[model samples]
Every structure is written in C-alpha cells, then in structure tokens.
Target: MTKSDPNRILRRLPLAVGGLGAVLLLINRLLTPELTESQARGDVVGVILSAVLILTGLIWQQVQPRSPDIVELIGEEGFVLAQDLPEAVKTELAWASHLLLTNTVTRSLIVYYQGKILLRRGILAAKAEVTPGPILKRVLETQKPIYLVALYVYPGRIEFDYLPENTQGVVCQPIGNQGVLILGANAPRSYTKQDEKWIAGIADKLAVTLQE
Candidate 1:
C-alpha cells in the first residue's frame, strides 16, 4: 500500500461515522416519538456529540505528522520473502522491484551482492563490478537505510558515482550481509519516510530469506 491509501481511509472515516450516527438519530426520532422531550433531546445530543468527537479525532489523526509504518501499510502478506535463491526468488524480487517503482517515483532499482550486480531493473548504466563507496559502506556497516532527498544538495555524495545520470534522489537499504538494495529516482524528495520503512521491511525479509 502507498501513503495515500491510509490518508484516503482517514479522510472517509469521519464521514462514515457521522453518517451512521445521523441514521441512528433519525431512526430514534421517528420511531420513539412517545419519549419525553428531554429524553429525545438527550439522545440527539449524545449522537451529535459522538459524531463530533469521531470527526475531531479523524481530523487530528490526519493533521499529525506520522512516519509510515511498513507493517501497517503492506501487512503480512506483502512482506512474504522467498525461502530459497531460485528462479522463483528472482521473480519475487522483480515483482517487489516493480511494485516499488509503480508506487514511488523510482526510475531504477539495483540489487548487488559483494561486487557483482545480482538484479537490476529500469534505467541504469551497466558496470562489471558495483563498488561500495564510503556512504554505502557506512550503511552496510551500520545496517541502516539511507535516504538522499536530493543528490545535488549533498556535495560529493558517494551515490552519484554509481547511480545513473540525472538521478536526483535515492533510498539505499542493506539486505543483511548478502548485498545492498538501491532505489533511484529523478526528482528530489520523491521517496518519503513511509517508503523508507516499507523498503526496510523488504530488506529485512530479504536478509532472512537469503540467510536461510
């Protein structure tokens, strides 16, 4: 799932809750006319208050800045990792690569093991040996993902050495000790925190699968 999915759900939640409350209130007013004026007013007020609180909560949730949670975004089925390195595994990797490309502004995806390219998709300059530069090495050492919102904004960024021409942003994640996964895009700030979390989850799954 992309970032927009949750936002869409959140946007509709208030409407749904409010609609339900309104329907219940209308039914109560029509069917229970025998109730005292005070009781009817109390019921209407309770329904209105409930709907207002729910709408307010929805608005607050949308206003709050939240980093996309990977599990919440994709759930367990989306995190399925192949158990062995086979044709199926390659297919699965390609599927994941394509999924990321479709969801984000990614133009190129590369997976490298040691000094050799294992899988590559989209536009990229070919090289015999993919060298791990200083920044990449640091990511591998720390086993953390790195996001460069704008390649040009960082002078002498190591990613520029290996990334394709005109690549503007990148999100690189270390796939255990097996290799590294790099995603390249042409626009600055194309990848969000949610993308990082999603890719990290993928990297973790890939690491576990490769180790097994």
Candidate 2:
C-alpha cells in the first residue's frame, strides 16, 4: 500500500467510469436515426481522443516513482511486529529516512540508552561519543518531537555544530527512555508538523516494540 498504489487506483477509477459513460452515450447515438453520420463520427472521435489522453495520463503516473510512508511500508513490508529488536530498529531507521526523503549525507539515527549511544545509523562521521545534546535533550525532557527548519539560520544551535555540514533541517523525536530518532535533510524547511507527527508515531512504535 505505497502512495503510488492508491494514486494508481484512483487514477484508473475515473477513466473506468468515464469510459463506461462514453460507451453508453455512443450506443444511444448509434441507435438514434436522427443523428447524421458526420455527427456520429464526431462523437466517436471525441471519445477516442478522451480515452487516449486518459490512458496516457495513467501510464505516466504509473511510471513515476513515489516514496512510501510508514503506514504504507507497514502494510507492504510486514514483520515489524515479528522481527527481533535489532532487526526492527534497523528496518525502522531505513524506512523513516526513506519515507521522509532525507538526504543521504544528512540522514542519521542515534539510539541512546543511559546517557550513551547504543546504536548509530546513517551518520556521516565517526565521533568518539554521541551525546543527546540540547536539542535532543529537549525532545527527551518534553517527550515531544523537535523540528529545526533551517539549522544554519539559528546561530549557535548544538545541532548545527554537530550535524553534517550540508544539513539544513532536522527532526528529533524521543523513543521513550530508550533512545531518540533523528532525521536530517539537506533542504531548509524540509519537515512540517505533519512530518513530525509521523516521526513521533514511528518513535513510539519503536519504543514499544523494543520493550516487548
């Protein structure tokens, strides 16, 4: 159930309905002796043109690539509930970053437990220690997500100093007391409140899954 799946279905639905209606109209016009041959031909031509355009649009949409969100991945790539903790965490890190369309250089996930990094993924550099700095600390203390639209715009921010040089935006969400999930992107204002909500939901799921 990726985003494209619904889009593809919706795109074809209108075409199906419109084609049926056009067929019915063509049948009625064909039966009507009052319709001139030229008029009938015009109607057929219009229907054919419309159908071809609709089909072409559908094909174009099908060919376009779409990123999948968490919900879609959960349905299409199951076993989130069955996999062990480590596997599930890795799967989630990959899925969350992919769904958010984070830049590869900036995308990262750091799992912290008892004031130390337990796992790291997608980070650009290898540092001696990965601490939950001010931004992450805020997320953990508030038990809420934090989204920095443009890290560079905010001078002296801890994240701007620590994140990859190309990072422009970041989203941080606490995974219970177990860890925090961090997603960074190369474009300013890359994440919205809606994105924060989705990330928070994933963090919560990860926290619960780890506990189980």
lDDT of 1 at 166: 61
* lDDT per residue (tens digit) for residues 100-192 in model 1: 777777777777656556676766554424677777787778878788887767775654455665677778899997678888776777677
Taking all chains together, each candidate's TM-score versus the true structure is 0.57, 0.50
- Each model's total of backbone clashes: 0, 0
- Identify the leading candidate in terms of TM-score: 1
Q: Please provide, for model 2 over 1-212, each residue's C-alpha lDDT reduced to its tens digit, 9 standing for 90 to 100.
A: 11335467666765676677677767877798798888878887878766875686567556655332211111111111223337765676556545544423235545554465544445443342556567777877887777777666766455433345555667777889756776656566646566667777767776876576
Clashes of 2: 0
Residue 61 of model 2 has an lDDT of 58
RMSD of 2: 9.2
lDDT of each: 0.69, 0.59
lDDT of 1 at 174: 93
TM-score of 1: 0.57
* Alpha-carbon deviation at 158 in model 2, angstroms: 3.2
Deviating ranges (above 4 Å) for candidate 2: 1-106, 159-162
